[model samples]
Target: MIDYQLDADGLATLTWNVADRPMNVLNQASIAAFTKAVERAISDPSVKGVIVTSSRPEFVAGGDLDLIRNIRDVAQSMDCSGPVSRILRRLETSKKPFVAAVNGSALGGGLEICLACHYRIVADDPNIQLGLPEVTIGLLPAAGGTQRLPRMIGIKKALPYLLEGRKADPAKAFEAGIVDAVVPSSELLSRARAWLLSAPAEAAIKPWDRKDFRFPGGSPQSPGPIQIFFGASGALLAKTQGNYPAQEAILACVYDGCQVDIDSGLKIEQRQFARLAISQSTKNMIRVLFYDMNDANRLAGRPKDVPKRSFKKVAILGAGMMGAGLAHVASTAGLEVVLLDVSGDAAEKGKAYGAAILEGQVARGRIDESVRDATLGRVIPTTNYSDLADCDLVIEAVFEDRAIKAEVTRKAEAAMRVDAIFASNTSTLPIGGLATVSKRPARFVGMHFFSPAEKMPLVEIIRGAGTSEETIAEALDFARRIRKTPIVVNDCPSFYANRAFAMYPYEAMTMLAEGVNPNLIENAGRKAGMPMPPLALIDEVSVELLYKAMKQARADQGSSYCAQPQDAVLIAMVEQFGRLGRKAGRGFYDYPSDGERKLWTGLTEHFPRAEKQPSVEEVHERLMYSQSLEAARCVGEGIVSVRDADIGSLLGWGFPSFLGGVLGQIDTVGLPQMITVCDRLAQHMPERYAVPQILRDMAASGRTFH
Candidate 1:
């Protein structure tokens, strides 16, 4: 709802207050009324100046992300674009000065409306973040944002923000020449009024008004833009491996739009918008990854009546890679982390790791020197459990062995408040076993942080058989506190990402067993544009650790983790010869501590008969398929919510981002086609190649992923 009031001074204030939402959303009804209001504001001569402000707690949030996301038809896309363009064009062509008073966030279409105004005045507060981040929803800014933004702000300046989709603060937006000025929240409306009344009432300059205004130095034809575009395109391709269609369309939109007239550019953007709208990845992404993840996180796996717990201090046990990285993230994100180890030196070493990362941030000017120091200071290093006596949560990262983990749990719980949650950072082991050692097992839950915790976004919050609902909520909260997305998975070995991901490298090696060369699988991973080749990843993760996991698997899964028949190269290196892994300086590839590690020539000594040759596609499929099929099984068995699992893969493992995520990859792979391919491989390797029922049915029904 809106109220238009005209004062005797000839200034009109149009206040927005949506019926009940905390923030305003541009829905069909709102857009329709908004367009009418725009027409009226432009027509009335009594209205000498106009200021758009919100009566709600915050300003307009954006177009409802779900609305445009669900409109799968071309005509619907056109219909949606019409009202947006109409309101913006009316504001642009208005005779009187038009201004926006942004009291809070002005995002997506909300920011677009501000851009359309002759003047935009934002409140100078940490809360006011403005940006045109339409790319997140698999769509570009269709309401003349592509045309007007480059003209309002120089193309070079606008391109970075638009192309990468970043949010800018009010001061930065002012410097970039996007917003007209910034003011305090108390005076935002008053400031907007003064600007509208006295500021150069020069009718808003539209991009279409000028011709020959060359785009910021990087015109597609110019060396600057050409190099940037092509270079960026190549990088995008490498990062996505041609898996995501959205980036391709986004690139095309910016390239074609900037080169042509404003009208032509809009058409290009609109066409791309429609095409992307109907895509399976787009819909699935909007539903599962974006919408679903957001909703689930807000729900936080707790009863609506439960009072939320906020833990400001967390004590993490052990100072290994996971423990150190966890301390870094926890400290940096405004939490006090008590890092404990067996000795003071071990605790300091973990603290040093956090210090190094902070130093890097300082070097990049990402944080001030003092802030970096203060962040490091927040991480208190100690060798005693008593240091965590008052801490709100204590997470153990000591060992995977039941006895060691149970001992750590008892010690951690002793240091906690009566209700302080205790969590274990175990990857494959069951949480129920770990919970048994806790004085209050209901307060103990599994908080499985992926390796290199600072870099990975996923933290599987496992709810064990005896874990309380409150414990699940607390772990989820703890994961968020450390800036990781938490997926509340029911306790199981390997949880989600690793459990589904373990077979990929093994299958790639299996392809090598069938006479495929080790180098062939490695090159296929590279040529396919994977972030890391299978062998290289294995080495970096330390082949020795994988060998340990395999030994553990032998006991749990009933047999040793074996490679494919032709995988004699690794089979001999890890199995027959007992050379162990990276720790042993042996394995499929040899690693010498003093210098760079290289592929061992000893590989030939292991596989005597198999030839070293295979196509790139074959090698890529072996690794990608195994992962994809298992991801499908996880979906079929409902181990994780479909959207959360896909997001987990994209955020957890380096599942080629261009595919959007794993489920997205399945759609792109064409379920039926992939199933047929799997069938062929199944004949030779049944255990590794069998297609999951989801994929088979998707293919059989001619259904696409959405």
Candidate 2:
């Protein structure tokens, strides 16, 4: 995989281009080839220095995750990480200057390799990111990243990149001393060669390898670093809530490694990496966040018979928050967007929302003023239905009411091309029911974008009974174009993500009605790795919205409706106390203009605390199992596939990635163990804790979701 060539000046150039793969990744086969190339260059008498670069778009994507995913023991973990570490160490300490000519993004093992070289010079491209981001996928940078990065920069500077898995573009990387220089793509190779040729023999030695080298920041024993370590530990625990072991492991690697010699520090890093490699958390993350997520993004569930389609123009009906956000994303993706509402003024206000966001991006230096102006210029705000006539797709982000949605659907369809697709951005209403109003039911579909569509990554593409394969293909294509992960589901109430996620907040309210302490309930949710505590999430989403949805469901189902225990709590909060939500600045928590929100003291007056409280573990399990059980029911009912269920849970509702997704949590907890927990929970609330038959069958058959 390594193409080795010697120049007239005795400079050896090793160009990495793995023939089979699009990007050069560090794997057994490629590592072995690279080792041979390094050995040949070092042993050859004619070679004076070496330059490493890649012919692919990316220098190296990272380690082969397939190999890391299969690592089952410490020995396998060491074997997976050790060889590359050894090879890189040899390259850096061989007394031969090596320069890394980074042409594109270099992350994890890719950045680790760059750190090993005597000097790193990257192409001056904003898209080129360089960082050690292994912690994000549940492992530390095993191949000498933890050791070398801290030495190259400092402990304080390196900790954020290593712990949080932050990436820096070419300019930021140069400012942070992660790379020596940044040059144009065309001059990358020549610049690397020039640095190698002009460097003295002493330049071959790394700072840490020299006996007199001192760390840029103080050592671990110094007051500043010790204080940083203290603060970082507390911050890590607070941020992670102790759900992720990888962060703790990374903190230990840097703190423990940097105090000793480079070789000893590397061994410390490898040992920690081996422990995390075979961790259950690591496996779950790699499976759901990596593998399953990749499957969803690639449109794995799309009908194979239909060819891929593209959208040139899309019209969004209603210029509220959701509609405006849709316009922003579509226009940003280079599609002409018609953002329409009832009046011209309303539509113009919606367009201003996108403009404000673009202005912020320009101020942050994230985008140039030219790019901002061009992107905003593509969104045409108007009240005319005739504007959608030439559009390939029209998505209505109107009111959740069926009559209002049906009205917009009929109007948009009347003004659009015959073959163009019509989509409703409804999260709860059944897509098939909504399609009944359309003259062309085959073209009617649901494209459910979460609130603040520009930020949320998920788009649940609901396939109605009469929806054509071509319509589904086009919907998936539009989701991809806007950079959202689309999960296709058969039509049903609340759909997959909302149906499964609703249980989370409902269970918390159930406990509140049972006299469980509100603080305890919120803490348990956060401790379980939920992005927001149940009460806080409810407040943010607005309790008024929840009450309305509950009332609507009751009206629709009539006598067949099954009222949850939380219904009483919702009624008392909204009707009895008139505490609408955060929007009203009065809900479960009392928001102040001058201070951070605190739990309303009147909560206990209404829902008094019980004399005895449940353990935190019990509360945590109740919250986790409630959501996973509903996800299992979705799978059993054939509403969603197993992979989509997991991916949707993650990207849709912020189900903890470290636990995988909801289904991944079930698999990790073991089918039998999950059933056992559910059975125990069912003793209290049978309806809420009812286990799906799919879990039992999988437990009996020894099957896993992954």
- Top candidate on TM-score is 2
TM-score (C-alpha, index-matched) for candidate 1: 0.87
User: Candidate 1 — which pairs collide?
Assistant: 240-658, 243-658, 244-658, 513-566, 513-567, 514-566, 544-582
State, as a TM-score between 0 and 1, how close model 2 is to the true structure.
0.99
User: Candidate 1 — which residues are off by over 4 angstroms?
Assistant: 20-22, 199-201, 211-223, 303-307, 362-378, 413-418, 435-440, 517-531, 555-620, 635-638, 656-660, 667-674, 692-706
Q: Which stretches of candidate 2 lie over 4 Å from their true place?
A: none
lDDT of 1 by residue, 61-169 (tens): 7777657776879998778776777677767776677888888888877888888888888888866788877666556776777767876775557666666678888
Residue 330 C-alpha lDDT in model 1 = 93
lDDT of each: 0.75, 0.92
After aligning candidate 1 to the native by TM-score, how far in Å is the CA of 294 from where it should be? 0.2
